[model samples]
Target: MDLSDKQQRPVPQGPRIDRTFFRQNKKINKINKLKNKIILVRVLTEILLGALRIVHKRNTRAP
Candidate 1:
């Protein structure tokens, strides 16, 4: 009886904790994805700007 009660008690609580944990994990994953996307955009913009600067310098020097 004691073992059965212990098992039953944990079973209900286990799923509850897991549900909350999964919800939190999903939120965190979404935030991480957004951050990564922002970082990627910033890096790409920097590279493009640098390339443009180099091209402009060459064009000006040629003339």
Candidate 2:
């Protein structure tokens, strides 16, 4: 039996996180895992923003 065009076509699935992507992702996950004495949404955002600022500064100063 011959399949129709739609039936023969492979269905696209959701995003698959590859090993390389997961490697960096794991680093972030680990960082987040290191919890402080207090855990708050505002504090988390501040920590992330501070990290971004340091990264931005380092990149801008790079030769």
Candidate 3:
């Protein structure tokens, strides 16, 4: 019985650790996705603003 208990103890512990690790990994993935989205938005806005500036310059020079 003692040997059986010892063997069974490790089995449950293994899955418990895996579950917590999986949860942590999920959280990290979500945060990374959000960060990537924010960076993409910032880059797009910068490009749009630069284009607007260029257009404004051209219009002013033409007039």
Candidate 4:
């Protein structure tokens, strides 16, 4: 069957967790999870850096 034919086919009405499908889905899920984690870490790091900079500025001008 052609790729377009596959695309036009109706979605399965029941769960069919075959090996290849499971593997690919798991891989894609891991990639998405990792990407989200990386984004969260980056945002947190930026916020912490900004706070530290502000604190440093205040401390330097205190004395």
The lDDT leader among the candidates is: 4
Count backbone overlaps in model 2: 0
User: Please, what is the TM-score per model?
Assistant: 0.69, 0.37, 0.69, 0.65
Report, for every candidate in turn, its global Cα lDDT versus the true structure.
0.65, 0.59, 0.66, 0.67
CA RMSD of each candidate after superposition: 12.8, 18.0, 13.5, 8.7
Better of 1 and 3 by TM-score: 3
TM-score of structure candidate 3 = 0.69
Candidate number with the higher TM-score (2 or 3): 3
Task: Give the per-residue lDDT digits (tens) of candidate 1, residues 1-63.
Answer: 123222122323543466766566556666666766899999999999999999999889954
Model 1 residue-pair collision total: 0
Best by TM-score: 3
lDDT of 2: 0.59
- Please give, for residues 1-63, the per-residue lDDT of candidate 2 as tens digits: 322323233333568745665566556555554533245766988999999999999999959
Q: List the residue pairs that clash in candidate 2.
A: none
Compute the lDDT for candidate 1. 0.65
lDDT of 4 by residue, 1-63 (tens): 122322232333567645666566556666666766899999999999999999999999956
Q: Which stretches of model 3 miss by more than 4 angstroms?
A: 1-17
